[model samples]
Target: MNPTRRQVLGGTAAVVGGSLAGCLGDPGAAGGDSEGEGVFTSFFTLADFTRHVVGDVAEVQNPIPPGEMGHQYEVGSQAQVDAARSAAFVYLDIPGFQNWALDSAENLRSNHEGVTVTDALANVELREIGSGHEHGDDNHEEDHTEEHEEDTHDGGDFDPHYWTDPVRSATSVRTIGEALAEADPDNAETYRSNTDAYVEELETLDETFESELSERSIDTVVVAGHDSYQYLAARYGFEVHSPVGVSPNAEPGSAEISETIDIVDDNGIDVVLYDTFSSPRLAETIVNESNAEEAVAISSAEGTKQQWLDDGWGYVEQMKELNLPAFKAALKAE
Candidate 1:
């Protein structure tokens, strides 16, 4: 909001832009950056979803550099200017996740009149942190949308990872479709058609997860890694237990580690699942210290891995190829 502060920030971005570009690979050619430039997003999954909805209508750019995790990436000054200059800036609105992005979204709304700003989570129902962590048989409580509408960036009451569920992802897709159409009204029809097709794919993915994991032998999502799978757990009626909490780099207390190990041994959980980006040391410790056969890495789909980028793995690919298998192993699904 302050002119002096903004100029300082933008100047910083211009300085970092060149050097970072060298390490950032080809923005348009690799991973989720479907085209070199057009509609830019906050991170990988959002970029992928934007690409599907935009189709050939717009080139979706990813701001997070190659191999850097979205949460950890420090957004440069140029990224904000780039977003403001683009047709639209689509971003995740979760609090504490990427506050810079949230600020940029607000600036676009207040300062930049022409650029469209879309919050991918706008339509999706949010879950309270640890909403379905209990063993009780119940769906999550309603989202506190109204209460937190004014300060959506405030980091309480809501979990940040809503895209982990395909059903919620459908809502996100439609929101993006609407934003793109708003930004480029002439191609509304094309964006609508593209969005519908993508939503259908998301629906299919939801069905697959439901049917396969509905009657899994294990009803709990036991992980030694990150707890980003709360949505997946809530959707399919599974309790969640992760001693490391929700962060990949979190260090669990000894008691927490002991409890996680106990869950593995007590439930006879075969696979100890870790967030793909996390160090395997903790998971390895859990596996070696408990009855778990091995520690497996499952993606949160927050950022694109280098290998996944090469393989062209997108949201659905991560869900099907990586997540489902890790879940099957952890849940002992037949």
Candidate 2:
């Protein structure tokens, strides 16, 4: 639950002291000015987009920080606490790409009663496995976890990887823009303008993906890690084949593992795509068994601190690198 706009303003402005810093710029990792207009506590990838959309109006703070692994992030540190305390509003993906964020949001709320937490997944409609568009059977392989214990092989209740789809990415930008406007009314117009520009860029990215990918002959099977790419699979007509579900931490059963391998064999999938944030252990094993050459890394919703900063990569550039290669490869897959 989020605090109202009035509550954030009228209540305590006791935010943790910090300056605006990015993953690549600072020596200590998290560094910025002690003073700023407002704070946006974002998880990972959305942080970059929020920064772009919010521009100078708000300083974005990532709970998981840059250079850190998003899947392995846990709460209970001074930095996390300070970020929460200072944030006027925080963005959380309820289905959850970040384990710490789920717990941290609650704890942050308890300490900073005025801090507003918005669940980005709340309004978006979700799709079941093989439900969105059928290129073939929904051969999505996922890791075994309590969340997937009753897993109907469905995409599960929470696929926090929604940003894989540019449309959803654009939607998140709008949501952040609205929140920023509410938090800083003086800069509302700026936020709107920023969002409009970013959305146009996303639309163009979507066009690029469709124009390139739609021409491919084999749309049936694409292999990647679990829970990271449903939005992408849905947006295009390709079927996602994964070795694990959304949580990279979850271990798939032997049977589930075998099934995924079989698909890679049958579909002739050549590349094993891993995100920049996660280890390629599972992807490598899958490649070994399926004879799919080797691992190819793509940026998930967010990227490593340095990767985001080094490449001067933002949302659009990241997506282009992620999907374009696959689109070209799919064309080659006979």
Candidate 3:
């Protein structure tokens, strides 16, 4: 069963910055723009939501640049201090995925008194990456170690890609809307109305995905990137197998790579799925080495918001385009 948005937000209760609880009343008490320069966050998607809600009231700065993968971003000392100094509020993922963002938030809050930090996942539930049920004991330790390395390397706490799932993403949008309204009370009505409309659109997208992919024949997918896809896997029925761990930078061991090839071959996988942030090289290698004929790039939409915007692909549209084919291929067996 899909968890409620409230359940997802509940997960962020563990986030640091005890200050967030009190500031929820008036985020603007620190500093927010009546006109411009309302910084949103590390992930471009959050900015997308902020734009939808805040509308013309505030312009958001999505600090992370294009092609700069958030999972591996390292904030410099001066950069961290500067981001804190300039922005009124800093929105970030609290789970291990954006630990660097969280670390930056902590530094910013401690240094400057007014900047409010909001966790995107604070109200969104998390999907476990490569759940143990599929990988078993042999891969459990390795997965854990890889998750740690990814977390340390990027400054994330848990899995930061919670927005991959539409349900959680809608919740995030609402949260941002509420925060923006609080930040700038004058435009509260507009923010609230925008969020309501966007949330409705999100609901439509979720319905489309559930209807489209729910009856598909394919059940298992093999991926090389290992940048997390738990939300998508959980939303649909597919079991995702990856050679690397949470951090896409982590290389898969030769043995694991071989094992993934065997799994793909043994299962007669129709295609190898790769995401935007991942190197398709390993997937290509596996397909070539195993003599598999099919391969495709499925957007996990991680670190690819600009591409989506540029391509005129919104969440529902992109997911449908990228995922429907795989489901059609996989479900054909049913």
> Each model's C-alpha lDDT?
0.69, 0.57, 0.59
Q: Write the per-residue lDDT of candidate 3 for residues 5-98, one digit (tens) a residue.
A: 1112223221222222222333344443221235546655666666677666555666666665566566556546544644345455333555
Tens-digit per-residue lDDT, 74-95, candidate 1? 7989988888766567776555
* Best model per TM-score: 1
Q: Each candidate: RMSD to true structure?
A: 9.1, 8.2, 7.1
Cα deviation in Å at residue 230, candidate 1?
A: 0.4
Instruction: Sort every candidate by TM-score, greatest first.
Output: 1, 3, 2
Q: lDDT of candidate 1? A: 0.69
Tens digits of per-residue lDDT for model 2 on 1-334?
2232112222212122122232111212244322223454555676777787777655577666566645545646664565454544454433234545545455555665444454444334444444453221111112213243234333344455667888877876776666555544456688789989988999998888887777665555444564577778678878776667666566777787788778876777677676666677777888887867767777665545666667787667767876578545743432
**lDDT at 77 for candidate 1?**
92
TM-scores of all models? 0.81, 0.74, 0.76
The TM-score that candidate 3 achieves is: 0.76
Q: What is the lDDT for 2 in model 1?
A: 29
Off by over 4 Å in 3: 1-36, 75-82, 85-87, 93-96, 128-157, 305-308, 314-317, 324-334
Off-target runs (Cα >4 Å) in candidate 1 are 1-37, 133-154
